[model samples]
Target: MSAGMAGREAPLSRWTLLAFAFPAAPISAMGLPLVVHLPPFYAGSLGLGLTVVGAIFMLARFWDVITDPVLGVVSDRFETRWGRRRHWIVLSVPIMMLSVYMIFMPQGPVTAGYLVFWLFVLYVGWTLLTISHISWGAELTPDYHDRSRVQGARELLLIIGMVCVLALPAVIELANPENLAAARVASMGWFVLILLPISVAVAVWKVPERKAPRPEHVPFGQAVKVLIENRPLRFVLLADLISGVSGGIVASLFLFLAEDVLRLGKFSSALLLCYFISGVMFIPLVLWISRRFGKHRTAAGSALFNAITVPLILLIPAGHPELALGAFLLFGVNMAAGPFLFRSIMADVADHDSVQTKQTRTGLFFAMLTSTNKVGAAVAIGLSYMMLDVVGFVPGGENSAAALDGLRAVYVWPATIISAAVALILWRFPLDEAQQKANREILDRRMLDAAAAAVETRTLHPGDAQSSGAPAD
Candidate 1:
């Protein structure tokens, strides 16, 4: 055990957790803008070719996926006085800020090359900040319920950020759908710029990093072997992909669903706001449910709940705002559960791995999951759009009735099946509250043993006793 884990307690305070999670606000604010707002803004507003812009975004995502693991490996191995995770967070700030600025505030004529270069740079920065931030949070506590509390607060702040960005564009566009072209996207950019630094500053200044002993550097081949044997991680990553793809399908089809199926095209913003608000309001309830049922079981239960409710949108009669609103409200019940639970569960998985292998590879585990999540998102968006295009469903529903049905089919069925699979796949997930506690005990024992060995070694050779703290692996 490294000196950092000697006499360490695994519980955290509310203030500490809050400070630890605050950066998620700005980071979450960047998500909707990058995925939803930026593409249309560039193609439609700036007159860039739609095909070219789409290709550039795809290329950027590919680049982002590749970098996630590399950054994770780097964060886990790099040690410094400042900390492992926070230094990456600090380094990522300027790169992200510049990327955000370039994407949202383009000056001269934009080309495919320009979009490709800057978008790739931006996602690399996003991956670095996000993977490190999440890996840091996972290391903060070993208590099963404390993990939920920390992540629940992050989800809350994330919702606040999402609503802020989503509402601004909708509010501005609602008043006059044609007005404030750049300002809509620009507002989110400015929000990220202003919020990113302040949140990072607070998190760094207030939250203390837990410097666990670094594991002996494993070669890449050995790292792969270790990962292949991490059963809990594999199970959770499977759940993550299934649930993430389902949600992504919904997001990809949301605007089309509201416009053509529900006839709420004019009030899409209001509909989105209703969904987010409902999800945010219900998080406390989910937290309580998690405490009672435990993380994996609760996650599976929520997936089942979503499976039951999400597809009901297909049955609602067209041109009925009341029915659509009611369905969205119901669907919102499980919206926050997927993200909140997956994060908490992954933490447990990391703990399990550390206990079994004597290595804390939180960063690499998180990065691999992050990369797979992007794959799910990409598949959902691409497949849904391709399916729509195949069925002759135009963007504005300016098409035949058959085309609308095609859009509706693509929207509902994939999500229904995927959510169902999430429940089935995760039903037997290995790590639970009791199992995690046992794992923590093993880790503590190993830590104490290592520390004793170090002390004995120093006593035997007094000249070798370096009055210094070492990281615990």
Candidate 2:
């Protein structure tokens, strides 16, 4: 091992940290726009049928599911002069930039096939960039609080992106186009074209990677077995799935609840702004909680509190935006905690796994986290839509009293139950400060041993060494 590799890591400089976190803003900026804005842009602006648009989106997301793990595994095994993660990030940016332009700024005679093809292309780029970024962040720090800071900065940037994207439509309204969707989508295309490349380039240039030794070959079955056997990873992923599905259901039903239950349909924008603003405001508090109480307790406690508060929405009368915002303030606090710690916790799981197996699977661990999140969200949204239909809730027509009641039930119950389940399940999460430090200590020793062995083998058989400098698969 080089002296630098064996030496203790310097604390991450603020510029490097912010640059590391920079790309998240644009990437996360896409989230709100994709779900909230893009559908209307396609259906109303482009005159696509709703059924066709829905099918196209579903197909794109499912395709994303397949690509995520593949990309993760590919990234885990990849090596380059630019380093494992930054090279993948660089590769993904151009693909996504072009695809964004294609999807958002469609040319003449758009069809369902056009949407599906370009959207799938967009997801491919998204998977590559996101998985690489997450795993890279996990690799950046080993200290518990530092990991929290890294993910917190990343999550904070993501929310900033979401807030920024949410504000764009209002800006677009001032442009006053005959086709709002066209202008909005075009603006998003330009945003990605400009921001994605610059942020990614800055990170690639400025950040220093701790290049862990990559073994020449890890069998497919062995990778699966390690993943399955990592109890902490399994627990965290399960907690993520349950909470992710709950949150997805709430998001899917939020507009319906705003209209039919809370009667704040007109104030939906204000209400959403409140949720995000409160989230941004509460990040420091969540981080403080994580540092003081540990990530597991902070996340689980936040979810438990959130679970307690979600059902209280049922008690708020119709048309009370003030009360709704107040409720969401609590929601935002708890919401902030989950992502902050969940990602932090996953970093620990990655570290723990690397220690156990003597291999780095940071990318694959985060792949499980990101892919499960997408899948769970998809299932939740589909089931929520199905249940709403079964409960006789009409889209535009006057809904019955019973239908409104069902909407409230759908929004509140699934989330509450699942969040509580997440809290309960996290009670068994194994990593604590001592355990994590012990894992890192062992990993450091392993690095020293590998480095010494490499030197000895080179001296003994300089011409015959094989795995030394072998290309990452």
Q: What is the lDDT of residue 204 in candidate 2?
A: 90
Cα lDDT tens digits, model 2, 84-130, are 89899999988988888887788779888888888888899999999
Best by lDDT: 1
lDDT of each: 0.80, 0.79
Candidate 2 regions exceeding 4 Å error are 1-8, 40-56, 106-111, 181-186, 216-219, 259-261, 454-473
Clashing residue pairs found in predicted model 2: 1-451
> What 10-residue stretch in candidate 1 is worst by lDDT?
464-473
RMSD of each: 3.2, 3.8
Put down candidate 1 lDDT per residue, 384-473, tens digits, no spaces: 666776888766537788998888888888888888898987888988888887787777777777767887777776655654443222
Identify the candidate with maximal TM-score: 1
